[model samples]
Target: MPLIYAKDGAVATFTIDNGKVNVFTPEMHRELHEALQDFVADPMIRVGIMTGAEGRSFCAGDDIKTPLPDLTPHEALEAHFFPHIHEGRTGLTRPGWEQDVMRFKRLKPIIGAVDGYCLGQGLIYLLLLTDIRLATPEAEFGFPEIAYGMAGAGGMTRLAALIPQAVAMEMLLLGERIPADRALSAHLINRVVERTGLMAEARAMAERIAGHPPVAVRLEMEVTERALDMTRDQAVDYAATLFRFQRVAYQGYGAGTGFFGTKHEAAE
Candidate 1:
C-alpha cells in the first residue's frame, strides 16, 4: 500500500509509505483523501498526525516518474467540479472532490512531522495546511516549480499571510531551497527537532491538542480560519459571537460568556 492508516485512542495517524522518496502518485492522492475522510467521520479520532514512513522523508513531492492523467476537457471538468457524485456503481467508490488540501483545512487539527526533504507542491500544500509543523534539522523546504517554468498553486497563495512577503516571494519566484534553520527563522514551521525525536515530539504535541475538548478545538480552528479574511473590528465581533454560540452549543465549557475575565492587577 502507498499509505498506512491507524488510530490510537483519540489520535489518528496516516503514514505515506511509497518507497523512500514517498513521491505522490494519482492513486496515493485518492487513498490519502479516503484515509482522511475516514478519520474525520470517526467521532473517536480528535487529532491527526501526518508523517512519512520511518527513516524516510515526509514527501519528495509529486511523482515525476509517473505519467500525468490524460483527460478530455469535459472529463476534466467533471473530475474537478463533481468529484463527489458518480453515475454508476463503477464510479461510486472513486475519490471525491475533497482533495487532501481541502480535507486538511477541515474541522480537526493535524500535525505534520517532517524528517527529511519536504519539497515541491505536495509537501508545500501540506506544510501550509498543517496546524503545527515539526521538522528535523536536516529537513529541506522549497517550491521548485519556478525551475520547471511553473508557479506554486493550492496553498502557495496563502504563504504571504503566514510568513513575510519577501520570504514567500523568494521561494515562489526564485525556487530557492530553505534549510530547516531558515524556515524556523521565518516562522514557517513551529519547531525543529532531531530526526530521532521528531515523531515522538509530534505525537506528544498531537496528544496535547487531542486532550482539549473536541468541540472547542474544532470551533476555535474554524473561527481562526475565518478570521483571517475579516478586518480587526469585524473579527473581534465575529469571534465574540462565536464564543457565545460555542458556549451555548457545547455547554461543556462554562456559560459565563466572558472570554477574557477580569483584568489583571499589576503588583505594587
Candidate 2:
C-alpha cells in the first residue's frame, strides 16, 4: 500500500507513500478509507493529518496508471463525474464510489499537508473533504482537468463554498495552477507553512483539535455540513435542535459544573 498511518497522542497521521508522488492506488484508497473509518470510530483518537512522506506536500491525487480497484475504473475515469449533495440531485447515471465519498463525509477533522502539485483526483481529495489545509510555502495546487479537456467535476461544486466566488470561478474556469499564498488569501487553505515545518504545524493543529471534547467536535462537523446548504432562517432553525435545552453543556452553565461536575466547579 502506498498509504502509511501512524498515531501520536490521540492524533493519527496518514502519509501517502513517497514513490509516484504519494498517489492513491486501489489499495492506497482503501487504506485511506479504512484509516478514516478507524479514526472516526475510535473515541480515543482525536484528529488526523493526511500528508505525503519524503515530500513537502500531501498527495498528488489518484494514480490513474494503477487506479483503485474497489470500484470500476470507468466512473473513476469520467471527466465530469460527481455526486450531487444538494436537493437529492444524483446527476450521472453511472455508479459512483458512493461508499468512498459518503465514508469520506463522515470524517470530522482531517488536515492536509500539501507539498507539491496536487493534480486531478489529488485536488479532489484535498478540497471536497479535508477540514484544515496546511500548505507549504513552496507548494502549489491546481485541478488540471481542463488541461486534459475535462472538468474538475469531483470538487467544482464545493469550490464556490470553499472560497470567494470570483476566485473560485477563476480557478475553475482558467484551470491555472496557484501557489499556497493565493489559496490562503482566498481562504481555500487554512494556513501557510514553510516546507521544512509542514508536518509539525499540522501535527500541532491536530493535537489542539483533539484536545477539544470529541462528542461536541464530531457533532458540529456532522451537522454543519448539512446546515451550510440551508437559508439563513432555515440554518438557524436547524441549528436550534443542536442546542437542546436538556444538554447542560448548551444550558449556559460551565462545563463539569452542572451535571458532570464533581470535584471542580467550572469557572465563570
Candidate 3:
C-alpha cells in the first residue's frame, strides 16, 4: 500500500508508504483523500498524525518519473469544463489539489511528523495544512518547483500568512533546501528533535492533544483558522460568541472540569 491508515485510541495516523522518499503518486493522492475522508467520518477520531514510513524522508513531493496524462488541448478543456466526461481518467470531478485542501480543513489537529527531505509539495503539506509540525534535525525544507519551471500552488498561497514574506519568497524563488535548524529559526516548524526521537515526540504530542476535550480542540482549530481573516475587534467578538456557544453546547465540559462530575462543573 502506498498509503496506510491506522487508529490508536482517539488518534488516527496516516502513513505514506512509498519506499525511501515516499513521493506522492496519483494513487497516493487518491488514497490520501480517502484516508482523510475516513478520518473525518470516524467520530472516535479526535486527532491525526501524518508521517512517512520509517525512513529518511517524510516525502520528497511528486514523483516526476510518473508519466503525465496525455490529453490534447480540446480534451483537456472538455475535461475541465465537464469533469464527468473524463471521470475515468481524472478519478474525480474536483482536482486532487482542491480535494486535498478541503480535506486538510476538515481534519482536526493534523500533525505533520517530518523526518527528512520534506520538499516541494511535501513542504506544503506542513506549511498550509498541518496544525502542528515537528521535524527531525536532519530534515530539509525546500520548494524546488522553480528548478522544474513549475510554480507551487498551495504552499505559495498560504506561506506568507505563516512565515515572513521575505523568508517565504526566498524559499519560493531560490528553490533551495533549508536545513531543519534554519526552518526552526524561521518558525516554520514547531519543534526539531533528533532523528531517533522524532516519531516519539510527535506521537507524544498527538496523544496529549487527543487526551484533551475533542470539542474544545476542534473549536480552537476552527476559531484560529477563521480568525486569520478577521480584524482584531471582529475576532474578539467572534471568540466571545464561540465561548458562549461552547458553554451551552458542551455543558461547560471543557471548562477544566473533572470526569464523573468530580470537579466543580461551572453552571451555565
Candidate 4:
C-alpha cells in the first residue's frame, strides 16, 4: 500500500510510503480519497496527521514516470465538460486530483509533519489541507512546477493567501527550494524541529486539538475557512448565527456546560 492509514484514539494518521521520496500516483490518490472519506465520516476521529513513512520526504510531488495518454481535442473537451463520465476511464489523465482532495469539505483539522522535501503537489497539500504544520530542519519547501512549464492555479492562490504575496511570488517564480527556517520566516510552517522530535511534536499538537469539544472545533474550522471570503459584517453575522445554533443545540440536550458556565449558572 502506497498510503497507510491508521487510527489511534481520536487521531487518524495518514502515511505516504511510495518509494523513498513518497511521490504520489493515481492509485495513491484514489486510496487517499477513500481514506479521507472514512476519516471524515468517522465521528470518533477528531483530528488527522499526515506524514511520509520514510524520513526522506513528506512527499516530493507526483510521480512523473507515469505515462499520460494522449487525448484528442474532442476527447479533451468531453473530459473537461463531463468529468464524472470520464472519471473511471483507464489511462486517461485526471488533472486536479489534488484540488479534489483539498476540496473534500472535511471540517476536521489535519496536522502536517514534513520531514524532507515538500514540493510541487506536496506543497499544495501542505498549504491547503493541513491546518497546522511542523517540519524538520532538513525539510525543503517549494513549487518546482513553474520550471516544468506547469503551474497549478489552486496552489498559487492558496500559497498567496497563506504567506505574503511577494514571498509567494518569489517561490512560484524562482522554482527554488526554501529551507525550513525560511519557510518558518515566511509563515508557511508553524515550527521547525529536529527530525527525531518531528512526529512526537505533531502528535502532541494533534492530541491537544482532539481534547477540545468536537462541535466547537468543527464550527471553529468551518467558520474560519468560510470567513476568509466573507465581508466583515457578513462574517460576524454568520459566526453569531452559528454560535446561537450551537448554543441552542447544547441547551436542548441539557448539556449547556461551557468554558465559563451554563446559562442558568451565569444568570445566578
Tell me the deviation in Å of residue 264 in model 4: 21
Clashing pairs in 4: none
Overall lDDT per candidate, in order of appearance: 0.74, 0.67, 0.76, 0.83
TM-score of each: 0.83, 0.77, 0.87, 0.90
After superposing candidate 2 on the true structure, give the runs of residues whose Cα lies further than 4 Å from its correct spot.
18-20, 67-99, 154-157, 249-268
Candidate topping lDDT: 4
Quality of model 3 by C-alpha lDDT: 0.76
Which residue runs does candidate 3 get wrong by more than 4 Å? 79-85, 89-104, 154-157, 252-268
**Candidate 2 lDDT for residue 95:** 29
Off by over 4 Å in 4: 87-89, 153-157, 256-268
Per model, state how many residue pairs clash: 0, 9, 0, 0
Better of 1 and 2 by TM-score: 1
Angstrom error of the Cα, residue 15, model 4: value is 0.7
Q: What is the Cα-based TM-score of model 1? A: 0.83
lDDT by residue (1-268, candidate 3, tens digit) is: 7889999887888888887998887677777877888898887787889898986489898887876566678877876656446657655443344345434558378889998799976777666657888988889988989888888543555887777889888988898999998998888998888888887888888877777666667778878888999999999999889878877766655445532122223110
TM-score pick, better of 2 and 4: 4
**82-114 per-residue lDDT for model 2 (tens digits):** 432221342322223423643465646888888
**lDDT tens string, model 1, 1-268?**
7879899987899898887878877677677777877887997787899988998888888777865445567665776666644424334222342254454647889899888878885566565547898889988888887788767442544787788989988877888789999999998888999989998998898877776666667778888988999999999999999888866664654433222211111000
Residue 131, candidate 4: alpha-carbon lDDT:
92
| Candidate 1 runs further than 4 Å off | 72-105, 154-157, 249-268
